[model samples]
Target: MTGSFAVTKHAEGAGVIRLAVRGEIDDEVSDALAGIVANAAAQPGVTALVIDLEKVRFLAAAGISALLEGRAATLQHGCSYQVVNARGVVHGVLATTGLLSLFQTTIRRTAAHR
Candidate 1:
């Protein structure tokens, strides 16, 4: 319950960074997430950051704060940030915090071609 989650990064477009997150995002993973976002922001030509949370099972307050901070950093660097495919408890946290509308979220469906 206190273990760290894994986050993977991928380049979607010319200036977009897509991050896929798996497992729980609590206090234990907040620092790691912050670091990951920082690193992504540091990349040259990254104009947008998108976090895919389809596989995320849990997200705590610390995780939410980290994401908000990341968004601020992205904005300061002239970049946009978003979170996608949030469900269950993760969706509840964002909705309750009024952050659901703050981010550009998209629903993802499994692809049969995969």
Candidate 2:
């Protein structure tokens, strides 16, 4: 089934890029998400990348891999990376994959309630 997703970027001053993502994050959306993060990581002055996943409903392995790849790309460019607002199944997947501690995560209520 086709999934829906959206990515909105907010430049936080000279070195931070905050990307807010919503909806399903699966194989269909991983490539696009990776592209966004990669482009931001490649920016000359960007030193930090924050991926906000509070509104995400599902995250497949492809999506997790994309995040890991983005983290590596950011680090290579001397930038820090963080994934926030992961909860429920998303959180479980990350944790089960032993990536929970690898990325910064913030547990928050789902967007539907807010």
Candidate 3:
């Protein structure tokens, strides 16, 4: 797993908040992810929260937990939740944990495809 990690928030359209996550999502950075998602969901006028994992190279158990927490927070706030660009290890982890079916997902073209 890479040492670097970042989650950048972007406001898209009227009521959509997109969080683009980069690098490894391990124990060290899981809490930050949860907090960011919760905050984004709690914001006024936010109708949906989108988490982008295109650049995520790894996802630990804690990271999965964080994603679940984010989903809960979004639901509690009456907002829709979605996860996008989950590929490679990140995609496998979510699928094996049965979380892939829990959230809405859309296929994204990777750099190689683009």
Candidate 4:
């Protein structure tokens, strides 16, 4: 069900940032997601920003917009971006919207991220 939305930022390595998202990504949390991504991607020396959606249960229009926004910000900052662990409805929405290719989906979680 409707779990409270949250985004947790973790520095996975020297130039990589991992944002682990939990719960639903809807209108209520889209802005926060965009802001976090923008900020992370803007960080000096950050070369990659990974969004881990393993715990995301729902994906809405606003969420997709936020994701697109995040991708733009990452690109603007010259940082690579990717989405991982999305499944079920979340995965379906991304694929249907043609964002699955945009985000460069890497569904499997690496041991280092766990």
- The best candidate by TM-score is 4
Evaluated at residue 67, the lDDT of candidate 3 is 94
Q: Per-residue lDDT tens digits of candidate 3, residues 13-83?
A: 78998899999988998988999999999999999998999989999999998999999999999999999
Per-residue accuracy of model 1 over 7-113 as CA lDDT, tens digit each: 88888778988888998988888888887887898789999999888889998999998888778777878888888899999998888888888987667543321
TM-score of 3: 0.90
| Best of the candidates, lDDT | 4
Per model, state how many residue pairs clash: 0, 0, 0, 0
Q: Per-residue lDDT tens digits of candidate 2, residues 32-100?
A: 888889889999888899898877888998999889888888888889998888878888888889887
Model 1, runs deviating above 4 Å: 109-114
Consecutive 10-residue window with the lowest summed lDDT within model 1:
105-114
lDDT (tens digit, per residue) of candidate 4 on 1-114: 345898988888879999999999999889889999999999999999999999899999999999999999999999999999999999999989988888998787666667
User: Candidate 4: lDDT of 13?
Assistant: 84
Relative to the true structure, how large is the alpha-carbon lDDT of every model? 0.84, 0.84, 0.89, 0.92
How many backbone clashes are present in model 3? 0
Each candidate: RMSD: 2.1, 3.2, 2.7, 1.9
TM agreement with the true structure for every prediction: 0.89, 0.86, 0.90, 0.92
Q: Model 4: residues >4 Å from true position, as ranges? A: 1-3, 112-114
Query: Model 3 clash pairs?
Result: none
